[model samples]
Target: MQYPIKKNSLVDETIRTIRQHIRQQTWTLNERIPSEAELVELFGIGRNTIREAIKILAYLGVLDVCQGDGTYVRAVDDFSESIVLLNRASLHDHLETRCLLEIEIARFAARRRNAEDIQNLQALLALREKINPLEDLEEFWIRDRDLHLAIAIASHNQALHATYRYFLSTSYEYTKLFIQDEDLAEPDHPAHETLVAAIISGDENQASAYARALLMPTIQQLEQLSTT
Candidate 1:
C-alpha cells in the first residue's frame, strides 16, 4: 500500500514514517533505491514529492544520493539531526512548551546530576552575567538559549535534549523575554545556575521549587502581553 505523507507537513512525522519503513527492513540503508521512477510508483506520489522526501532523509545523514546514481538509505535510526526541518507550529507555542518541559525535566535532573554539570552551569551563568544589552539582542538571546540547553543536556536525557531544541528554534518569546525588560539586561538569578545547582546538589525538590519560581514570572509577563 502507498503511504500518504503526513498533513500539516511536519517533517518529524514524515521522517518518522520513513524511518519506520527502514527499521522494518522495508528499505535497506546499504542497498540501492528502486529509482525515482520506482519511488513514484511505490508511493504513488509525484516526482517532486519523492525528491523532497529523499532530500529530507539525505539532509538527516540517513541517505546517500550520488549524481546519476540512485538514492540509497545510509542510516535510519533517530531524526534529531533534522529538528530544524520544521514546518508546523509558531514561536510562542514553542516557548510555552519549552518552559513546560524544563519545569518537568528540572525535577528529575536536579536529583541525577554530577559535579561537572554544576561547573558548566556556573560557567554559563558567568557568561550570561557579562551580557551587556548595549549590544544587540540577538547575541544575548543566543547565550540565553545556550545556558538553558546546557542545563537540559546535563540531565543526560536524549529525549529531553531533542525536545528542548525543538522549542529553541521556534521560541520568539524566549528571545523577547530579556529585551522586553530593558532594565534587566542580564538574568538576575540565572535560572540555569539554580537549576543545575539543585540538580547537582541532589535536591530534586529544590529544583522544582526554583523552576516554578523562575517560570511563574515569565508566565505573568506573557499573560500581560497577551492582554495588552
Candidate 2:
C-alpha cells in the first residue's frame, strides 16, 4: 500500500501511482483504499496532498469517497479506463489525434455551419487577430484554443464537439508546450483566415485541407522532438 511520491509534481505523481494501482487490480471494485492517514505514511506526504489526490480520483469516477466510510474503488470497464489512459498519452500522440479530429471537424463544419456559427467563428478569428503571440503568449494560446473549439462547435455534431473539448482539456499542458516554442511565436493569421473563409464558403475540401495545413507544422515539430 506504500507509494513513493516523486520530488517533482507530487500530487500528479500520486494520482498516477494510485490510478496505476487500480489498473493493475491491486485494488478491486468496492474495495476500500488506504485511509488518508495511511496514505500520508505510504507516500511520505502531508494529509493535504493525499486528500487532494483522492478528491481528484473521486471526481474522475475512479473512486467513491463516502463520508463516515472509507473510499472505495469504482467500477471501470476497459472502454472507460481507456479514456482515463488517454490523458496520459504523449504530446506527439495528443497532437496526432488532435490533427485527425480537427480535419474531420472542419469538414463537418463546412457542411453544416449556419449563420450563427459563421458569426461566432468570425468573432473568434477577430479576437485571435489582435493577439501577438510573441508579445502575449498566454492570451495567444487561449485564443488559439477558443478558435479551434469554436470551429468544432460549428460542426453541429454534438459528439464531435464534446470529444474535441475533452481532448483539449486533457492535452492542455502538452498544447502549452508547443505554444511556448519560440519558433511558433508568430501566429498563422493567414491560415486562420483561409480556414474560416473555406468553412464559411461551405467548401468542405478546402476547409479540411486548411485544417491539416494549420496543424501540420506542430505535428512535424513534435515528430522531430520525439526522435531527438
Per-model clash counts, in order, read 1, 0
Q: Flag clash pairs in model 2.
A: none
Model 1, position 197: C-alpha lDDT score: 69
The C-alpha stretches of model 2 lying farther than 4 A from their native spots are: 1-80, 183-187
Q: Please tell me which predicted candidate would have the highest TM-score against the true structure.
A: 2
Tens-place lDDT per residue, model 1, 92-173, is: 3444555578877787677666777778777877787677644766777777777778778877898988877766766645
What tens-digit string does per-residue lDDT give for candidate 2 at 7-81? 788888888888888878888888998899988898898888889988888887889999999999995543455
Q: lDDT per model, in order?
A: 0.69, 0.85
lDDT at position 223, candidate 1: 61
Reference-based TM-score, model 1 = 0.57
CA shift of 63, model 1, Å = 11
Q: In model 1, which range of ten residues has the least summed lDDT?
A: 84-93
